[model samples]
Target: MVNRSQNVYIIAEAGVNHNGSLDLAKKLIDVAAEAGADAVKFQTFKADNLVRKNASKAEYQTRTTDASESQYAMIKKLELDEEDHQILIQHCDHRGIQFLSTPFDFDSVDLLVHKFNVKQLKISSGEITNAPLLLKAARSSKPIILSTGMSTLGEVEQALAVLAFGYTEPDSMPSIEAFHFAYCSVEGQQALRQNVVLLHCTTEYPAPFEDVNLRAMDTLATAFGLPVGFSDHTSGIAVPIAAVARGAVVIEKHFTLDRNLPGPDHKASLEPDELKDMVRSIRQVEAALGSPLKTPAPSELKNISVARKSLVAARTIREGEIFTTENLTVKRPGDGISPMYYWEWLGKTAEKNYEADEKVRR
Candidate 1:
């Protein structure tokens, strides 16, 4: 399990960018590990089981691939079988990075858990409504990261209810009131927190900045009392890096070997150098976000005396001269009385003589 509190768990989503070549897939793993990403994720699904032959492709998919081709045909060319899984897993072990795949069917789920031994399961946004898959994941009891895109809050609630109770049928389940009571209880909430994490996302590929609605991540965190993250589909690394600053415990972004590659997701994906820069920027942001307590930082403490102002004599004055606003002024080198006491210092007799541009004495 990822310790989200310590650092942002970064997953470079290399979905379908391998273009059905094992060599390309292994190269993707190498890129991810070199970029300092925590894991490299791929989509594990048999095209036949995932989509029907007649299913239409989304508009963005049509623009990226052949418009005449069906969704199944497009995805079929990208399927990775069991042998491919073994090769990729072994390569990930050698490269020192975690291997993750989003299972679209029950068999694929089992293959990943039983055969590949994936530590956790990442459920894609489209599968949030798939009851059988959700139940299978819940029974496995491995940590789950669920993405919510093209889904309403009620749909998210229903999915959480299924995971919390390990139930499939929504009609025969307990009432919403009872479900809330159980889910909010100490033990029940703890179990959910231990096993599940929610991710806020927009369903669009290369999602628009106006549609990002990053505040929704915090809303999910507050609503469920669970750790929340952002699965970014934006055009650049700025949004994901910004998500980290806004308290996303995990950040999943699509990446490719080259943006010019012919695929549905490559245009919106980050390249090798950009991926490394994203990781570096996220670490810098995390360090800059430091403590919550509002106090002077170590670097700024030394500057206080040099930058602040002190009460100084505006002109030369003799001993026992009365201090007044015309004779006293604020100046730098704040080793003397602070300007905050300027009002009180006025109308007081000076105990000692002071020269022009010198600090005023009480």
Candidate 2:
């Protein structure tokens, strides 16, 4: 969804940290806007449509939330209705930040793209295999950010094939072969290039550092030949900043009004100040990743003569005198002949007289 001219897009993922409170959600919007995030993202889904009532909570979820509550029950409480979406969007508009949400089910996808008109759609890592949902998202024609986590390259490719099919939707019946055909077709590839951005992610809350595999971002770029970014779940701002350095075009990280707030994602999320630090650090890294050419930067050009060496007289010498090893040396103030000609200048007649520590001329 980002143009080539734009800096790395940073998304402050407020997620379910609002804990079913509209005031808290609006406050999160304010925090993200104040932090200078490109967008503030929330999770939008009816828990009934997403998970079975008896579905178990994930280990990380259980640790952060009440283990006694079923996954559906916990998420059911976090569900943001249509009115909630409108309120959050208006809040985001007032705060001057884009509003985004991850759609976990078919209706949620429709709600985000059709009703609310979000600029882009973010497909969760868990939905990478949910072909129906992926197809529905792709069919909407909105740009999609697909997260690859707890999955293999092959799985990511398969998900992409489904998306490709949805985007190019040939007249044939939907099937694995049709999806493969679409993936192999020129039209499907072109559609993907224009509308999809892949995100490298690790599917764990507070994911381990070793498991991050930031290099996988490169692999995703190479293998898929699409714009790639990162969905960070690690403990701090460092990894995401490093990801930007490594050429991630977008960075999405979870944030909360307060870490100690009783919610599933709060503990793994950055607090307000930490979120600000993260956005500032990411912008700094983006600026540092300036040009690919290996040459002196504009700021360092003036320092070259002062810092580099040039041929100079080691001791006093008369005009037309023979330049010798003992009389010639390399020194600073490189406006004179470069030290590379030290051997050539040796034993040659000096064009002009020079004094001790003076720059030698041809």
Clash count for each candidate, listed in order shown: 0, 0
Candidate 1 lDDT tens digits, 1-362: 56766889999899899999999999999999999999999999988889999999999998899999999999999999999999999999999999988999988999999887799999999999886787677667678899999888888887787677552323445556645555556655676788888999998988999999999998899888889989999888999999999998899999999998988899889999999999999999988999999999999999999999899999997888888878989999988899999889888888888899998765
Q: How many residue pairs in model 1 have overlapping backbones?
A: 0
Q: After superposing candidate 2, which stretches have Cα over 4 Å from the reference?
A: 170-172
lDDT of 2 at 126: 96
The runs of at least 3 residues in candidate 1 whose Cα sits more than 4 Å from the true structure, single-residue gaps closed, are: 167-187
Candidate No. with top lDDT: 2
State model 2's lDDT.
Answer: 0.92
Give one digit per residue, the lDDT tens place, for model 2 in 29-69. 99999999999999999888999989999999999999999
